[model samples]
Target chain A: MPMWEESSLVRVVPSARPRKLAKVPFVELADGRLQGVVSSGSDISRVYVSSVAAGDFAFACRTNNNRPCGGLRGGFCNHVTALVGEAVLQYGGARVARYLQAETAEAADAAGTAAVPTAQQLTAAMSAVRPQQSADGQAVTGQVFSRFLRHLAYLELPATTAPLPEMHWFPTAGAVA
Target chain B: MRADLLAAELPDLDEALAAVDAFDEVLAGGLLRPQPAQAAGLNALADAVAGSPIAALVAEAAEKAAAGVAGEEHLVALAAGRTALFGAVHDAVLARVDEATGRPREAAPPFEPGAPLPVNLLASARAWLCDVARAGWRGMDHELAATAAPVVSALLPSAELRRLAVLLDGFAAELAASCPGRTLEQIPLRRWADLWARGMLLTQPGAIAAAGAAAESAAGAASTALTGRLLPLGVDLHEHATGVQAQVHAVFEPADGGPARLVRASVSAPKPDTVVGAGAWQLLRPHLSLLAAAGEGRAMELTGMPVTDEGDLLWSDDRAHVGESADVFTTARVALPAVRSGATAPLDRHPTRIAEPVLVEGYTVDGSGAEVAFVIGGERLAVDTGRVPAASPLTPQAVAGSRACVGLLRWDAGRFRLQPLAVQSAAKSKAAVAQAGAWAGGTSDKNAAKAEKAATDAVTVLRERAGRLLRS
Candidate 1:
């Protein structure tokens, strides 16, 4: 799967203000993406999606409120992660991988001669970078996957989709076709 | 007697007697007629006298006229002369009384002691003592010693008593010489004591003492009250007054609440600026000393020409500017000379570059009192001191602004900081631009741009000069 397509799901709180709540709807995206809003208080909330199938992803979020509040965690919530993951599984990660690789290559070029690795090459490098464990040791793939997900979140990416733009989702096979 | 001559003389005699009665009435009434009318009346009387028998009887009428008694001219002259003589005596007595005590001499109840000494009197005594001390009168006689002792006792109960007493003794001895062969009743001990006190108050010791006490007490009370309400901020309060172009008293009080015991100060001067009266030095002295002890920096004393009436130039002639209507006064700018004491590292030795004299300007409104303004270079520095009386010592704060330039040049090296002292308008900011321009050798411009340019240039020059001095 493409690194960008490898989505994770995490819970979030929703904001309290009427305008903020209106901006974050409870219904799925117009294109059939799964999404839900969560909040710790009326003033603060996080719109998110969570699923066992998808790994966890979260970002700090902010409102127009002048008071100090949390920011969008990696610009995505669990709901967006779930939506992306579902889309990725149905469509396959090849196109998304290509897109992510192109963006990273462009960034590398801008930074002046850092090696621009392909998506497959980057995945291979990640696998190598993971610490080796004993054969009888506990399965460390979950930890490795979590660390990789965090590193991908940290990576600055060019905006592929405009924020709060209309979203579309398709069934896995149909989308791939 | 010839019948015709006798008849003519009789009528003249009657006229003369009538004139005498009129003169007696005028004198008895004690009415002060206008000068011109009085002169005219005397002239008319004198003309009648010249035509009378008295002139005819006198062989040497010209001689009598010269003596101012025989003819009409003589009578007129005598009247004017007598009037002048009486006026002079009155004026002299009034002036003398004002000098002896701190009140108006002509006012009722002259020399009323036991009442609180006028603030100006205390300030003057303090200034006089300082001058005497500076003059090395430490070993002066009883009169001098007496002059400073009581005044010092009044102000500084704990410190410098012995020195002050010696000065007062010398002053008292001098007084003894003035009252030759007179018994104590003729000039009572109380009167003598008051005179001695007045002298000391005019000097440095008395001013220092009164200012020290007033500043210490007031500052203590204020600090105590303020500390409870606000953050524990240390404040030094000073006060002073002036009269007739002399410093009466100046006082300074340091923070008494903290480990720093309040440093009390006072001083007096004959020609203190209107603000921070002559007595201000007494109030300010202790603070200067305290600041010096704290290793704040060195003080610089800078003398400047007072502003003149025509607004033409600054001159050192003290008499030139008085009574002339002008917006600026020639202020004696005292900048505490730079001292190197409290710095962690050795500073670069800088040549002492004297700063340009600062101009203190302000206007006097009839009911509102004197409002003085001070300008240092181009900027209008805040004047934190009180009103300026004719006679008083300048306060350290009054002098602090000009001293700021000195401070900038001389790094505060734990010695004493030079601060600007001024006798200027209380409205420090508004008229400062004009003052600065005047100081920088430019006529006050009505145009904003020109005035601003002049101010900028003056400031730049001052800063550059200060910096160069510091570097050197």
Candidate 2:
């Protein structure tokens, strides 16, 4: 399927519920990772996905069954899945692929060496990302196709709320924040 | 050769003459060189062929390289050799300890019927007095002392009596007689000495003096009951809206038989204003971790409650129960089978059982209470920082990944945690990286902000220089 054909992440989040994913403030950082924040009860969640790093993850949430009310707990959840899905819909799969590539390039540079991606490779990847053809051998598009994935990844009622820490958790070791 | 000789560079002519004399002896008669086959020296040209200024500079450079550059490498090699040596030592110690102690006990054992918990208030007080008494008491194990030193250096939990009582409840009874009023309070040590020297501490001096014969007879009959023995304590602690409560069982033998002591105690949370609070992630975080590591039932001789300045039970930063002294709570940090977050290696059953501690390096906090980053097996890994007491003085700044501490690494759920039973030493913050760098290492919030900016600036400069060098 084409990059545009990649379904939106809104459907995956269980908390995205009745109204579905709230479609405002979808942010893509300088590094190409995307995030969509949502509020379930008093618990504000950052549904984040990185093409390069650990992709499709939840930061702080009110309801991760195994862990306390914050952090990247409960590895696989609707909120994290939803963010990645939404990003796919907004930026297209091509953009995600590009982000991942760029991140890899940066990492390579940091480690003292990096290979430049060839134009032919880029074009080949771009071509392969297209949607499959219809019955008439034409690209499939402009149809009322819908996507539905049943998931109970979010809260049902009174959202899980625990106190947030005074400071945020960031990996700041050698360099300052 | 003539020009080089004329430029011979010693400030003193006497040194030059001495050099010439030595060269003449070597060339003419082999006086300096005992072997006749040695290369002949030019004695007549010795004075004229004095070494050049270049020779002096070359000699100086050679000396500098040996003392400065080569010496540094030598020191590094020495340290590496020492590290390998110590690793072997560590392995040897564990091997011996494991062989002697028949290792590998179930961490979270299956439920068994046993005795109820007792709230031994004197245990905590006397444990505190153990510190007071440690100064004079001769029974301390100095070898074992090194093991518990890492974590204790930063965070020694609790200042109030209630906290101590909750942890080591069995102490006050032993320590009470030493106090002036014979109460479980922090009293002067002088009074304890006065009472102890008279041998009035056990039972009563008056009774012993007056009824010597009767006392001896009674003591002989009651020796079995009075003899000091360690009773296995199995306690289950839970946190609820009301407060923390513990179901303690003092198990002796025979599973079906009744316990030696049965007791019930209600534990209240700490005062809200003091650091931890109810409903706060900080409070729930450590509990979740401990529960994962040891599960419910805990077996240890000592237990402590997290108490406030006023001795209120603290559940979180803002929530706690108002309680009087002698309240029971379970927040004691267990020494064995330590938990390390994000570890890949299988936990050695033998390592945790050893009472003696190995040296642990300082660590940086990952904030979520799960991840504590440190270098182990030569790689920097973030592991779970297991079960730290609320009152323990651990700080993010001090325990940063950049610094080093001494402790053991424990693993749970595939994560390694730094179980710093005792702290060894911490690095000198920015002074470690650079002395003149404009980084302010402070404990305050403002200083934290400044340090960050300085770090960024430092990185930017470094990157720019790197880019320039790379391009060149």
> For candidate 2, lDDT tens digit of each residue in B1-472?
0112112232343443333333222212211222332122222222223253233332332233223332322222222222222223334444343332233322222322222212233232222332332222222222222222221111112222222212121122123212222222232222223222111111111111111222234334532122111121222222211112221222111123322221111122221111111122222233222221122223322122221111111222122122222111111122222221111111111121122212333333444544555544344545323222222223334355334433333322112234432232345443331110011111223744543344344334323322332233
Task: Tell the DockQ for candidate 1.
Answer: 0.00
Candidate 2 lDDT, A31-104, residue by residue in tens: 21233332233433322221112132113222221122343333423443454455444444334444434233
DockQ of each: 0.00, 0.03
Q: Report interface Cα RMSD per prediction.
A: 43.8, 27.7
Tell me how far the alpha carbon of residue B49 in candidate 1 is from the true structure, in angstroms, after superposition.
53
Candidate 1 lDDT over residue span B1-472, tens digit each:
0112111222233343334333322222112222343334333344445543443322243234323334333323334332222223333332322232222211222221222334543464455443332222212332343354335334322232322322343333333222221221222211222222223332322222222232234444542221100000011221111101111111111223222111111111111111121122222332222222111111112122111111111111221111211121211121111110111100101111111122232322122223222333333333323322212223333333332211111101111111222333344563231111111111232553343353344334323322332233
Q: How close is candidate 2 to the true structure, as a TM-score?
A: 0.22
- How many clashes in each candidate? 145, 69
Error of 2 at B163 (Å): 33
Predicted candidate 2: what Cα RMSD to the true structure? 30.5
